[model samples]
Target: MFTTRPGRPPSWRRALVTGGAGFLGSHLCTRLLDAGTEVDCLDDLTTGRPGNVEHLAARPGFRFLHLDITDPCAPDAVTGPYDLVLHLAGPGAPADCRRRPLKSLDAAGLGTRTALGLADRDGARFLLVSSAEACDGRGDDGPPRSPWDDGHGDTADAPDPIGPLHTYAEAARFAEALVTAHAGARASNAGIVRLYPSYGPRMRTDDGRTLSTLIHHALAGAPLTVPGDGSRPLSVCYADDTAEGILLVAASRSVRPVDIGADPEPTVAEVARAVLGLTGSHAPLEFTDAPERRSGGPFDGRPDGRGPDTGFARELYGWVPKVSWREGLARTVTAVSGCPGPAPATTAGHGTGRWLP
Candidate 1:
């Protein structure tokens, strides 16, 4: 657990979450509603599952809007004097990126622009939920490569000047730049949150993230396919902790981007073993989402070689992850399996850095 910075946490009367139906977005929506804030959850369901927000639809002060943030009409569709606008309207999963490549680019570009505009108009605080690609904060992997050369190694394309397509990392980079530019030009109360990896309920089984894939394989009694000798440091945070960190950043008036995540240190193989133990499945390990398998294709559940940085999050908001990966993973398993979680497990791998593994 972490300490709350000395001060009153920021509160909102109402909020607008662009990707409110998505995994993390849905969590944010639920948190805001629980705080007695009116929430207008909007999503076109491009990469988001409607069922994620279905439970919240009946809750008081919750409104689900089926609208694409990239659509020109999106502006008119959202009538509001919102105090907060969380711009999380983008394809979050690797599988979604592979299936909807252009949509990823559009969300980062047009989607971010639309959300920022709405926030500025309503005089609301805005937060652009971003991926780790916003910066080379993690030095383990080199920068993105040319789209054509991605098959060689370190998958991802450079931001093309005139190309219609872009990789998810490129899209995230562009989105952060846009948010920064928006704040500079209009002096809007906006910030960007660079998320590393998070796992919990509502995660799509086919999302291709390391933990999601491992859990899926364990539950199905299938092989736990891994990548790169399964030694990558894949740290992660629980959805509940991630949601609260995001809200903390949103409440603050800082515009600088902050990294939010927490967890015990663990290698890919260790993560897989934990999943298998929890499910009580003897699923064999299979190293498949490896470098050789990247082929410049969509992201395959690989953790970016870098660890989480909680410096800004701690200094600014006094935020740190509350749940260990084991605890969070157990909750996720119970949610997915519709049964009581297995008995309490031993402590997760020792040591902590960024919140996920």
Candidate 2:
């Protein structure tokens, strides 16, 4: 169970996690429960599998509700006076977003609105789990120092119009705007967290994110596909660290968007090689042609000095990612390779199969 550190006091008692059956969401649920908080997990299972949370079903203070936050009756279905509400519902996988653009948009737009409304009604502190994509298109340079950092004295560039490649990014940007507006109205105490590429256990093999795809390819002894030049840098946080960063923000009084990710950012090719090394797979690296628009360029990946500054989080909540990428990737490889086949239909007194639409 989570215990109070020397300076931090217990902040959450009851919590609700939207998208709580998915990879990062499931980790968040586990962490909250470990902190001795009663948790109600809401998920539609569109991309989240029940097996992810089957272990938690028997936990005394944990309950999982199979429902989409965007549904009209969702708020009524899960009545709550939760002390904290974490909005993590949304399609973040590139392929999933490309195939179900509307669903992705609705999840960020309508889903966030619904979550915000629920938090407002319950007077709960709200946390919006946004993405690094939200800061996309701001400029070719890099993300601003902080979400609150509007370039000092420098004229801000005109905002780019949403386009095909930016569907998910645009949706997240919209969600941030909505959250900002809601906070301005004092609807509820709320904060926005922009997550970089996060990877760990329970990541879907077909999710279309690079790290998971690389690991899956290594496991199957298939070619690891690296789109374009493979120079796009990514700073990935383990699921546990990402969840902890979110909780730090939730427990704090700050509402500004703090970036949650680790540094020494590795290139796509570097990550592929790491996976191969870890799994001892001889999978060949295949560089595929990608649309020019989709070919992301290199990024500044320094931990504390350059790129998006995480100092705000450190000073405010004393948060910094503990797990190194090498270690985290190894753990992920073990978990994925050892994952059991489709779990039994029933386990821990709750359904483990896919929830119906």
In model 2, the clashing pairs are none
Q: List model 1 lDDT by residue over 225-253, tens digit each.
A: 77768776666888998898899988878
lDDT of candidate 2 over 31-140, digit per residue (tens): 88887898989887777778899899889888888777787778877777788899988776666677678888898899999999998888888898877644522223
Best by TM-score: 2
Q: List TM-score per model, in order.
A: 0.82, 0.83
Segments of candidate 1 deviating more than 4 angstroms: 1-9, 133-166, 292-304, 338-357
| Residues forming the 10-long window of minimal summed lDDT in candidate 2 | 343-352
The Cα error of candidate 1 at residue 66, in Å, is 0.8
